[model samples]
Target: MSLLSTVRNPHDLKKLTAEDLPALAAEIRDFLIHAVARTGGHLGPNLGAVELTLAIHRVFDSPHDRILWDTGHQSYVHKILTGRADDFVNLRQRGGLSGYPSQAESPHDIIENSHASTALSYADGLARAYALRGESRSVVAVVGDGALTGGMCWEAMNNIAAADRPVIIIVNDNGRSYAPTIGGLADHLASLRLAPEYEQVLDVVKQVLGRTPLVGPPLYDALHGIKRGIKDVIQPQGMFEDLGLKYVGPVDGHDVHALETALRRARDFGGPVIVHCVTRKGFGYPAAEQDDADCFHAVGVIDPSTGKPTAAGGGTSWTSVFADEIVQIGHERPDVVTLTAAMLQPVGLKKFASTFPDRVFDVGIAEQHAVTSAAGLALGGIKPVVCVYATFLNRAFDQVLMDVALHRLPVTFVLDRAGVTGEDGPSHNGMWDMSFLQLVPGLSLAAPRDATTLRAQLREAVAITDGPSVVRFSKGKINADIPAIDRVGTVDVIYRSPEVTPTREVLLVAVGAMAATCLQVAERVASHGIGITVVDPRWVKPLDPVLVDLARAHSLVVTVEDNGRVGGVGSTLAQLLRDADVDVPLRDFGIPQTFLDQGKRDQVMADIGLSAQELARRIVELAASRAPALTTGEAEEETPAGQR
Candidate 1:
């Protein structure tokens, strides 16, 4: 039987011998490569973290001792050690193992810390709580070099250093978050990665030579006693130690023995400490190691041998469409610039960056800094398009409201994955951007339904020089274009019932990708003698005045969107209608205000009752409910979302 089979938990891991661990580590890498390649979870990050995870578990008792993983994608190995290896078959599927640590899954996990640079703050808080309660528990946070770039990590470190309690911070320095970690911190770590370990095997050999019973004893003696001298000369001190936290490495992250030694010393220090572990991002897998683009950071189901994806995505995605259009825009306008918070390729700005290398700025996982910096760029007459994922943009809301919107800068914010992005869990969903962005006073938000509109709306967003503008799109492939019948101001009427009756029953407002679904609902409702007009208001915010006129012309108004029900486009329009004294009954459908489960996008949408059939049935019920209102001559009742 394999050694991994014998281990069911951290307790079982503690039973393995020193000689047995290397084989166990090997088994884990083999298991991860096969399992992740089959299911398509995070492959490279977990693979690099195997030995480091093993050493951490073996040294510290988990659950009792809080072990936190920042940007929890690196916790797959940690999950395996905590007895979840059997669940790998169903990884990332609905009702299966979450890609990140779920507090419900086990007591070992502190939080669903998928966002980068959060674990340190969690660690600092936990340590403070434990100290006050008289609970003597060890707090350890394993943060990546990539996560370190986020300002919050440094903020937590400042508090942690001031504490009297013991806190072990394991800096998992594989020199990457997604790509090679950029900025000053990367250079500092790179210097330390190149430095030799003072107390390891090579240094021990020097000690042996110094005590040799022969010649060259004097020269060897100098080498033996040169540990501190060499450290002061090569290692750049004061980055961590200067913060009042004791520093204890340049240890090999893959070397279990060395990592354990460093961890034990840090654990015994009885104060805040930093243990730097230098490992490779895709340590054992040659395919991942050789991969320059994100080191295969996140991969789909792949052939284990060549590490190529088995399934191919057939159509052009929204990201690709934006990528192509943005490059064209870059060529046409030299003043146009771009910015990303460490994700240039994922956000579809790589091609733009390559085309105009001087114009693209990667701000290294600092979204707040990226936003304010873009404001600075706009101040210099540069039209900066800040490209970021919708979910990630939530972090920089203040900067958007203050630095950009308040100043009325011409900066354009492009939010990719602006809807229900599934499989990455609730924390990764892009459902909140529209809801939060509604609060920005001068910001204009656009939701494009298809590839053609995406290109057009993106251009429209950039041209708005009066204030900040947002062009948001969903993840995955572009739908077939929903051609507009006519432009009624900012609204595009996509569908209208054949016979326009005097008592118009429904005017459906389709938001972004929900246009197709709304069109389907219109067709479904038409079977029951109900008339509906579907329109796409390309720019959802600053709703066109024509909508109020359209609503007054109809008995019922329905809006469907891909964002959260609260404070989103649907809710915003409801407010607009209510303020305009258009007493026509209105109903809006969207994702309920809740954290959604991980699943296929269609499955999640259907589960949330966002499907066409579900919507059509509700709209029919609402229309039927109003039949009595027309006959009785009573004012129509505004339908509550749940009554149907």
Candidate 2:
């Protein structure tokens, strides 16, 4: 049996011989390749962390000792060793293991911090908690050196060092986060790698001094100061040391034995210690190593040998739609430029980058910087199209309001995955974009119901110099090829029959990807002899007075969306109806106010009552409750014009 097969937990890991650990690391690498091929996941990061994770577990007792993973993308190796090897078969599947560390998935994972640069603060808090409770447990945080580019990591490091608490920080340095890391931190890491002899000399001196006990303690203290001074002259830039934390390594992260020894050494140190491990991302897998594009960071089910996606054909994704549109706009408009928070390929801006290389800006993993930069770009006579994940855009709320909206900058925010993003779990869900964007003054938000509307809205948003504009679209394929629009506009009724009575019992206003499903529900309701009108409110924000007017004409209006029912388009319309004194019974069909679990997109959406069948049933129930109005009944005739 392989070393990995025998090892079920950290206790099992600790029992392994030094020689056996490397074999175990190899086995784990082989296992990851096989497992991820069968069920796709983050391949590159897992391969990178095999030895580091093993070494960490061996040195520190987990469950009792808290270990927080920054970004959680690199925790796949941690998952495999911690009795989750079997779950790899169903990785990132419905009711299966998560792609990232999840608190609910395992006890060993302390913080499921999917966001970058967040684990340090969690580690600091845990360290303080342990100290407050007089506990003996150690607090360890595994943060990527790439995450150091984020401003929050610096803030955490500064605070953690100020508290001077006993905590260990493992910096997994491979010089990349999504794309290669940018800004000051990347330069520092590059400098460290350039001076390879520094680590070798330090190691030799440490070993020699460690042998003599009488002078060892004093010699090590003096050597540390000398090393710091030497680093100042040679390296001159230790970010962690500058922040007041004890610095260790530039060590070989692939050797489990050496890494364990370093961790044990750091454990003995009294204050916050940063162990900088230099490892290769996509280390063992040749496919991952060869892949310059994020090291196949998050793979779909793929052929292990070929490293190509196994899933078959689909039309262009919503991201591609935006990227193509942006490129077209960039070609047409000289002032147009693009910005992304280290997500160019995923957001489909690669072509744009090639075409307008100078116009495109990859702002690392700094969402805050991307937004503020867009604002600045707008100020400098440029129109910036900021393409970012809907979930990540939450990081730039202040910049969006204070910097952009207050000044009425003509920056277009393109939110990709603006609804339930399956498999990524609650942290990655784009359900809150509508709710959050509602609070921003002078910031107009649009939700495109189809590819055609998305194209129109993009053009419209770019032309708007009156204020900041946000255009959000869902993930996955655009099922239908909508007719190209000549001009920019908002709110279009796609399916309506003039032969039928003007009275619409159920006026369906669907947003983004939910439009097709809403149409299906309308068709089902119509077949059952209930007249319904389906409309796509292209602009979910601005409350589209026209949509409210349509709602006033209906006896029962049901608003369908993939976002949360609370503070969503449905909620906004309800408030608008209430404010206008239009007392129509409106039903909102949306994802509930709860964290969703992982699954296939359709399966997950169906589970959340977003399926056409489920929506049709709800509509039928509503129609059953509503008794038909008598012809002789005198009506108040609540006019929609006055309500608007």
Candidate 3:
């Protein structure tokens, strides 16, 4: 029988001896490799975290003592140790196990939001709360080296160092987040990094010291003091100690016995301590280790042997389209530059960086800094395109509004994954960008309908020299070309129901990826002799003057967008029509203003009533509910727009 089956919870793990831990760590690594390959989750990070998590569970009594994960993608091992190993089959599936740490899943699991550099603050607050209550509870936070790139980590660190309480911070330094970590912190950490041989030699010294009769503890303490002197020879920058936090070793993270000893020292310190554990991202798995792109940071249905993705993906992705188009744009405009928040490859900026290495800047995981830095670049007469996921853009909204938009800088923020991104759960969904970016005055936001529009809109967004512009697109496969019949100002008249004259009953305003769904809805409604006009308003913000007339021409206006309903394109258009004094009743269709759970894109969209069938049925009912006789802005009905 396997060791994992015997240990269902942390209490069971506590029963294992020191010798059993290495075997258990090996088993966990194998388990993660196989399980994550099948279920498709964070493979590399969790693989590296096996021994660290095992040591933590063995040292700290969880549920009573809190253990927090910085960006909870590495919590798969924690979940397995916390009696969730059986749920691996349903990982990231609908109503199944979440990809990150879920408080609802178990009391042992806390801090559900997977945003980086946040756990230190949570740990600080939690530790202070426990200290205030006079309750003795060990609070530990395992933060990735990648998360340290963010400014919030330092802000939290400053506060944490001041507080007089036991809060152990494990800096899991695998040295990459999607790609290798940038900035000085990573380099400083690398200087103090010790080899595995040195750690084993230290362990041997510890064993030899323990065998001594009475001077064992004192000799160990004397040696620990000298270790700092030895470290100063290698790297004098004691970054953690300077912050008023007790600093522990740059210990070999893969060594379970070494990690346990370090953790034990941190647990009993009665104050904030930093345990720097150095390990490889893909420690045991050769495929993941060989993956220089991200060390297989995340995978999707991969073969365990070769670490190749098995899922059949269709044509060109929206990312690839942007990737190719941006490179072309880079060639055309030397003034244009690109920036990413440590996601050089994922956001499809690798080629641009390769082509123009001098221009592209990887600003680490700091989105706020990335926005402001792009502003500085724009201020210096450079047109900077800050590319990031729509969800991460949430972190730098204030910076975008003030630093970029307020100054009227020519910064184009190309937000990939701008709509519902499934499988990564609520935190990863890119459904809020359109709503908030709408609030930024003078900022033009474009929502592309297809690969063709994405390239076109991206070009248009970069050409603007006065104010900040945004060209946001969805995740995954690019939509098929939605050929336009006519261009009404900025709007593209994509579809107009055939054989239905004069009286247009409904106007379907499809934004970005919603064009295909709106077509399906329009077709179903049109089969009943109702003339429905579907237009893709490529640029949503600063509503075109043509849309006001389009709304005036139709009896009912329906706006569809792959964004949150609140203050989205639908609501913005409704407000615009009301401001224009047109009373065309609008039925706005978009995602519900709520946190969506983990599921496939189609499943989540259907559940939120954004499905074609659901929208079509609703539109059909709305047509029947309209006034018996419909009138446009004039008594004479306008001619139906078909292929015009």
Candidate 4:
């Protein structure tokens, strides 16, 4: 049996000999590559964090010690140490191991928010609570150097230093969050890594100060006062020490012993201290290390031997559609600029950045900065297209509202992965964008049903110079073009059952990516002798005026979307129907108002009854219930198929 197999938990890990850990680290990496290759998860981050995680587990007793992870995707190694090694087979699947820290999973795990730059604030609050309760346990926050680019990290650091709490802030400097971390902070950290000898020089200076007779302790105190100045002379920046927090070495993060020693010394210091540990993003795996695009940060099922994706690539994705069109737009409009919050490739901005390097701006992990800066770019007569994941865009809501919407800036916000993004779990789902953005007055939101509409709508969003515009799309392949049989003003009539003749029993309103499912539902219902008219409202927000008339002509109006039912496009349309005094019974089918678990996207949709078969059954039931009301009224002549 391997050393890793013998160690089930941190207690077991503590029993391992010094020489046994190297073999254990190797076992852990081997296990991760195979397991994650089968399961498809955040493989690269976990692989890089093996030694650092082991060091943390060996030096500190968890649960009682309150070890927190920022952007918890890198917690796979931590999970393995906490007796979850057996759970790898079902990782990120339903009822299996989560991709991130789960409070319900174990006492060793806490703070399940998978978002970035939040660990420092959480540590500050936990430390304060422990201090008040007279608890002597230590609080450690393992934050990535990438997370430090966020403004909230700085906010927490300011308060942490002022409070003078015993919090250990481990800076996991792998220098990435989806891509090479951008901005001045990344440059500063590089400088720190280059000056590894400074740690030894500082130790000698401290020893010399201690030996001096009368001025020994006083000079040591005075040396502490001038440490920032001394750091500036030797290093490019002294920002950390300037904040009144003790700074430690850029230690070898791959060296478990060195990390443990640095952590132990920081833990012994009864004040806030930062331990900078440098490691590679994909340490052992040559394939992952050589991957320039995000270092394979998040990956799908792959061949372990070659590290290439095993699964066949699907058709042109919504991202690819945007990626191609945006490049064309860049060529047509030289004033157009693009911005990404550290995700240059994931959000489909890599080609755009490469074609127009001068026009692209990667603002690190700071989404809020990305938005406000886009607003500034718009004010400067440059059209800024901010490409970001839908879930991460939630972090910049305040900035989007005030900086862009309030000023009615002409910035275009492209939200990729805009709904029910499964496997990464609840925090990763892009289900809340439509509901939240509805409240923004001047923001016009578009959800395209196919690649054709995606290209058309993207151009429409960019042309609007008077106010902000948003284009949101899902994670997977773009659906085949659902040909518009006819047009009802701005709405595209996708499917109309020929069997029902003149009278339409149901008006199916499909929102964005839900068009294919709605069409399938329409076909299923048509078998039951119910006539359906399915339309895709290319622009969902500010309900197209023609929908009020379309809803009145049908017996039942069924709205379908991939977003949550509450405050979604369906809910908004229902309200509009009521305001227009249309008596048609409205039925909304969408994701329930609750947190969804990790699973295949199709499985989650089926589990939640968002499938075509399920929706067709519901629509038939709803139409049957309204039969009594329809019978009470006089029969009217059915209009011709396209006449309406």
Per TM-score, the best of the predicted structures is 4
Task: Point out the worst 10-residue segment of candidate 3 by lDDT.
Answer: 635-644
| Candidate 3 lDDT, 1-644, residue by residue in tens | 98989999999999988889888888888888898888788999998899999999999999899999988999999999999999998999999999999988999987895989899999999988987899999999999849999999999999999888898999999989888999898888877684334445556667877787687677878877666655456555477888899988778899989899999999888899999998899889999999888999999899998999887776799999999999999999899999999999999999998899998999898999999999999989888999999999999999999999999998999998988899999999998999888899899989999989999999999999889999999888988999999999989999998875555478989999989888898889899888889999899988898999988988888888889888888878878888899987777778877899999999998887788888887677767767533322221232111000
Give the Cα lDDT of each candidate: 0.87, 0.81, 0.87, 0.88
Q: Tell me the tens digit of each residue's lDDT in model 4 across 416-520.
A: 998888898999889889989998988899999999999999999999998899999999888988889999899999998877733548999999999988889
TM-score of each prediction: 0.94, 0.93, 0.93, 0.95
Candidate 1 on 222-249: residue-level lDDT in tens?
8644644566676765578779898888
RMSD of 3: 5.0
Steric clashes per prediction: 0, 1, 0, 0
* lDDT for 444 (candidate 1): 95
Candidate 4 off by > 4 Å:
206-215, 219-230, 501-504, 627-644
Candidate order (TM-score)? 4, 1, 3, 2
Residue 341 of model 3 has an lDDT of: 95
Instruction: Give candidate 1 regions above 4 Å deviation.
Output: 197-232, 502-504, 627-644
